[model samples]
Target: MMSGEVVHTFGFTVYFVFALMFTWASHIQRTNPGAGWWALSISSAFFARLLYFALLYTGDTRLIITAYAFFIVLEKPLMLTGIVRFLNLPITTRWFWFIAALADLWLAIAWVGEFDGFTRIAGYSLINTSLLACAAWLIFRHHKVVPGLSLRIAALACLALAAHWLTAPVFIQLYPAWATTGFAVGTMLTLVQYLSLLTAVLSLFQKRLLESEARALDMAFLDPLTGLNNQRYMTTLFDQALLLATRPHHIVAIFYIDLDNFKPVNDKAGHAVGDEVLKAMAQRLKDCTRSTDICARVGGDEFVVIGTQFTREFQVEEMARKLLEHVLLPIEVGGYTFQLGASIGVSLYPEHGNSLTELVQCADKAMYHIKRNGKSGVAVYGGETAGGLGLREA
Candidate 1:
């Protein structure tokens, strides 16, 4: 069995180490809102342990006990609140504060007057276990959505911590002599729980890091204004679509679209309204395309659609019509209604050209044909016409 002072000092050291580690992690990852809450949780635990040691060896019983009461009431809730924040789940912090205040009031009134009773100890155990169990349930409920190994391990650790707290009261009641000894059941369980908790905290940090990296990758490939895949992503998709058009009669069609009268909207209203119109157009394009199709904003007011998995060639023309119907929908921005139009140039594999660049160039010329003749129309490239052979008015 360890000596009382040794066990207390060791536990304090562990808590302090984790507190600092969590604080540092939170500082570095300050962009994540949950990291701040997690840092507060671990820091609260450290202070609670510090007060426990002061009660044992240094401070006045009443003053130390009062400070402990306040700290203990805050500790478990802070930890649970951190878990809720980390999961991006909702929690009623007002209720937590109310309950903590009640617990503090009880401790001030009942436990501060006498230091020899087990009732206060039992109450503390029940309160701590309940809070821990609530946090464990919250974590476990998200397992289906999150399903990461770190998340699973953290949920299990929370359950173990809850169990340790719940069982502590029983041990205190059954073995009074041992409960008063150097290596009490409560102290041993707390040490184990803290070690498991440290592991859980590390897991949470790992998950956050992975999520941050994924968001960065997405931002790289996505257009912020239109929320569509950017040119770089579209190029990769274009190549994949070309490869998929391997079987006979399987065709890949490219539609190069340019919005008509878009600059006038920006000049008349403002850049903000122009941005809204772009977003609206992006959604319309997505709505018109098939799930297998890739629609991207390759440049300002310019979009591309890659149509694939089509056995019939005429389906490409129908897709072009649908795109016009959707993109021409009435858009309302800043209380002003506007109607936008598009000119599209179409190019098909094996008929227009085999390569992406040739297809794009053919489509560009066809689109310019529509723009030069009359805006708000679709033009298809074909031989003899070379630039554009077919036109459909919008």
Candidate 2:
């Protein structure tokens, strides 16, 4: 069997390594308060163990022992605080002070009563057990919100550490010969807890990084003013839809919409009101199209709608009519009511051209046909133009 001195040396060495690792992590993740608190917790544990080990060689003095006890009691509260802060949980300052006071009172009672080493160990174990259990409970409760395998593993390690501490006193009382073995087991459990927590922290960092990247991609591809897909993204969608439309009967309709009298809204009502009018128009375009369709704001007063999986020409014509009707609806923004109209030109796949550039050009020509004949109408490529029922000014 190994001596108590050997076990203490090994445990303190492990604590020292973990403390350095946590300190480095805290520095790297300076924004995370939980990581800083965790560093402090491990550092406190290392200090307590180092002081105890030093006293073994030097004479054990009351002041030194009290300092060691103070650090030992301080470690668990710091760990609990780290867990609470890391998970972004709400905790009262008063509760933190209350826990710290309770721990201090227990340490004082043990010191003043001149408790034996075994009694001190048992009392401190119970307190540490309660704290570890609380930490485990908090992690488990929030596991769903912050999902990761590492988090669950960390919670389980905390629970196991709590159970080890809770049972240590009983095992030590019944089998004094196995006291060193109990200490060894505790050191192993502490090691597991530390590693698991480190992994959990890394997992959370990775999650944040992935979410940030996704948001960045959205900002790059989305239109800032209308919250619609931009021209570049729309082109990408058009290519993908072309690949899916392999059947000879499948028709993809590209509608190129040019707003009538939109510039006057910007000039008369101010750009702010014109922006609101554009947003309302974009929403109407979205409502008229199916989920499979792609709608985008391609220019200042121009939009594109791509409809896929259409088996007949009339379906495309019907969709074009719906879009023009919806765009012609009255828009009320900032207490000012405005009526707008649209001239939409449509071109079909295979008949117009294979590529997006070809289809858009064909659609644009068809739209100009409507503008020349009369405003507010839908025109089909290689076909006749339908004029608006009622034409209105800006």
Candidate 3:
């Protein structure tokens, strides 16, 4: 075979590979019909391109190129849709594909030689330009929602296809061989794009798995009702906090928060409603906390919040103030609102205790003092006096 034939032959073969791959992918998506639709649509478009090229390079006839130009153009937008749908990226509809198909049919059939060549060029240019503009719009709209890797790879592929389509007129002049060479390069480009998509898909799956595992771990160590770390987990957290606190410039605060009037909800509305109220309260506590803070439920209506990266005592106090307010507010559920409040006691590192047990004991004592002082407040453990421990308002 001539070199040109070789160039064109593999070009057709590459398209065939894409066609079969898309078809097989769709077929195997028996459980996922949505994905199957996407695959079939993409495969059809690739099949069209393959058939067009298959005829052109083998027979060396204007008939194939002339007859299939519209088919080729029509396939472009469908190609995009396939990728978008495959990635589960959002799209409104097939409007772009419809418009492209119409434009392609008109251009392929209507263009005459010489006199109309410029118009043909302009026609295809406008249509292809619209396709590119649409692709860009899709990318921009989804940039924030799409993952970084997926965005980079998909966007590059779209832009490449657009470039290839737009340069049709000029490519003929630069090197009459440019088209054949582009075919070979394009095959490699397709392979790279496929690999990238595969990477993105794998990343997505791995991300989901990590999230699931994290949730499972959380459930194992978290009190779902109060959204606080369970006793075992909180103890571990306390030890970790203490270790972190030993470092220079690292300060940690341990707080034991006890709810006031919590038993009333369980008594009046029953445990089910009480459970709902508890869940709501826990969510509020979570909302009030920073990401680095560890909040845990150590007992019934008893919770703890550990603050890391704390440098000053005031930070702990401010946090207590926020927590107090968070728990004091009325929670509304099922058209009924209920008022509840919490008492909090804080103990700082080095001062409260050198050990986790000492710190927790000190904070617990301070919490009792707050309860005795009539609740809805914060108390901090002061230094030990000659007789006993000291509790101060925070």
Candidate 4:
């Protein structure tokens, strides 16, 4: 509805605004793969439009027109490449760059050789539409796997932009009044595309936020060094297992494990090597314990294994032997082989104590009894220290 000059000026303003906004956004997310490319594409497109209006107002120059046409044709491919990178898809660098270069060359030749206005328009429309169509195909093909509504909308926006460019030449040829209204229509279409792109950007930020929160939650419950459950996580499982132990014929076994002569390894080799020993031991403990059992690293050189569903008394002893055998195996760390040993003290539900704290204290006392007699051994909680194998008076 505005005059041609006003429409053209406002159109330039819109492009400049989006260009600046995307540029700022790209800097904020500079680490992201496709952000920089998309920013450059948007700014280049804005530059092309600015030059087009400048040439029309002043004396027309074929070279300047060619440069503007080059950027206009270049925009879609840049955007498509950026989208592909954003989606983590493989890029065929050779074929894509070759085709883009050849298209630009053709446009340059056409403009310098004095091609008619309709010929130039057709050339740009065909190339730009084809590029947008390719982008749409890529988005649609991957949409189901990613399953984002914003991505779907982005693909539809690409299709709509392609359709607009494809029909532009025909509309100009058929309708004599198209020249008057063409700028307004082009500006509106550009606005729609810009808004769609903005939506996709917001969607990406939301996805990143969700991923960060999940990582934080996982870190809360897991030990980063040993990749095992922490003391807090073990306590939660212990409480749950305690409630289940109230049923008939159910017994919960707690093993308080300590690494024997472990400080010597840290003194001989640096803490880095000692860390490797701990990781290797953690893996071995996980392998020795049954799937129903929960193994946790509760201290620097202390671990715990809680097992439920103990049908036989011998099963716990058998597991303790396996734990000792695995931990005794020599581990290679930082090109040095070191022998490791473990002392475990086991306490059972109802037999040792009813509560988790009582069971742990019982197990700890039994463990210290083993440590006092010898470094590496397993002992069960007996009636009392005076009465049996390894236990304190009740």
Candidate 5:
């Protein structure tokens, strides 16, 4: 083998072996789908590049270069496709993928007859234009779905690859003396850039995995539907609130809210719309409470708010009014709006009970009374209230 051929073989073999190993690791990155696609797409580029170099080095100039050139054009398209899917493209547009794959095959076949570089140029134009369009659509339109750091790094790498190939014709014109140096420099720079990208992708994935694990751990004590602390979390938050209530100066008020007709919303809307409504309602509920007060989804369409350090019951009373106003607002689904009402029960800590269990029970019973009387009103625990008839257990 020629010295040039040996160098090409060595370089490409190293590149592809690394890429091959990365493929396995990328497949396992289910947590960060963006990183997975970024890795796989980049690995594809290296795999194609390795084969291209190997073919060129062995002097398989006719068929191999033809195949390699077709592959080179396919690279950007494939990479953008992966990125688009990762960033959450509408699944209904799967037709685009079929079209892209067909373009690759057509280009591969169009190069077979060697009818000049015209067909290759045409093929390259199709692939390049499509890739640019896809990339632009992904970055601009789907910005919300993609994480910031990964997007910037990945977009740079893709742009770099596209720019590198766009300027390949200029380099192809190098004089014999300048050719080797120019090619070596270009190759080394390209390798270093892509290698850096690979490492960045790996780092991004590791960080994502850690965050996912943390979220998973948090979810273990969280209610997924309402994005609230679960029963387990309630126990913990209550205990902490309990300690705060022990001081003679401190008072905590618990407001328990139950939906009047929430079952029909879920039953009719299907789980997806129900989920959306729950998430929407959750945001509204959180907005009504102070940050110092803890609000949690205690059950299906049931939420509990613990208001602490509020000087008077009227402060909690005002909060309850705002909570009702927000929850009563219409939630839209498929261009149609529906309303859900709330039944609120209020109980004060230390006054209601000294323990977490008793406080919750009192609040829960007070909530049931509001529901039993008429589902749209609030009930406060105390002899000063006219609606002591509204409380079942206070």
Candidate 6:
């Protein structure tokens, strides 16, 4: 059987390695307060073990034991505090200090009273068990929010370590001859606890990296002002719609809308109010289209709506009329009321052109045709005008 001193030396080495790893992590992630606390916690454990190993050869058992007990009692409270901070759980500073003080007082009482070895060990072991159990409970409670296999494994390791501590006193009393073996097993459990916690921290960093990438993608593909898909994303949607249009009885319709009398709103009321108007217009466009349709802000005062899977050409005309009616509504912004109008040009798949660029060009020409005749109406690419519903007569 391995001696107790050998097990202590091995435990010291484990704590040292973990201390260095946590210190490096904290240095790299200076913004992560939890990492710093974890580094401190592990470093305290490393120092306590180092102090014990150093005093082993001094031949003064009382001084060595007292120093080790004083330093070791600090480890659990610091670890619990680090766990709370790392998980972003709400815990008061007073509570942390109170727990630390209580642990210290208990140790002082055991030492001053000259308690038996078993009594001292059992009391300290129970304290450690409670702290480790609390850490495991905290991690388990936050599993849903900070989800990862590593975190779950860490929680399990903590619970196992706590159970080991809870059984340490009984094992030591029942099988004094096997105390060395128990110490060896506890040291292994402690090593596992350190490794799992380090991996769990790395997992948290990975989650943050993924979320940042998603936000960047959103910024790249979406318009900042109106929250609509930009022209770049519209091309992708157009290609998808074109693929669906290849099916029998399926048609794609594009409505190119140019706001009439919009420039004056910007020139007179300032760009801020003009932005509000554009946002209102974007919302109206969304309200007028189906959820399957795509809406995009392609240019200044120019928007596009693409509808797919239409069975009939008349449905396109009806959709165009709905858009015209919605655009003609009065917009109220900043205590000012303004009536807006739109010149809408419609293009159909296989009738106007094949590609988005070609169809948009055809729609642009038809929109100019409406502007030449009279604004605030819809015109098809093939000279068919949708005239009704009190539209502006040309």
TM-scores, one per candidate: 0.64, 0.85, 0.57, 0.70, 0.51, 0.85
lDDT to native, each model:
0.73, 0.81, 0.68, 0.77, 0.64, 0.80
Output the number of the lDDT-best candidate: 2
lDDT of 5 by residue, 1-394 (tens): 2344444555556556656655655677364454455455555556555676656646755555465555555555555555555556664335455656776676666656564444554555555555655564565555445345545444454455456445554454443344344335434544654454455446657777888899997888788787777777777788777666666667788888887777887788787887788888888888887767787887877888887776666777888888888999988975557798988888887777776677777777777777887687777765335644334332
User: Lowest-lDDT window of 10 residues in candidate 2?
Assistant: 385-394
Error of 6 at 20 (Å): 3.2
lDDT tens digits, residue span 276-298, model 2? 99999999999888888899999
Which stretch of 10 consecutive residues in model 4 shows the poorest summed lDDT?
385-394
Return the lDDT, model 4, position 263. 95
Clashing pairs in 6: none
Angstrom error at residue 44, model 2: 1.7
Tens-digit lDDT string for candidate 3 (40-128): 43454455456665676567344555455555566557655745664556566578778777776666555444225435545665676
Tell me the RMSD of model 6 versus the true structure: 4.4
What is the lDDT for 26 in model 2? Answer: 78
Residues 254-276, candidate 4: write the lDDT tens digits.
88899998998899998999999
> Could you give me the TM-score of model 1 versus the true structure?
0.64
Pitting candidate 1 against candidate 6, the one with the higher lDDT is 6
List model 6 lDDT by residue over 1-394, tens digit each: 7776887888888888898888787776433566677777777777776787788889865556567666666777777777777877777646655665776677778788987767777776777778778778887777665565666776787899889878977887888877678767866776777777787777677778898899898888888889888998999888888887888988899899999999989887999999999999999999998878999998989999998889998888889999989999999998878888999988888787889998898788778778887788898887335662222221
Clashing pairs in model 1, backbone N/Cα/C closer than 3 A = none
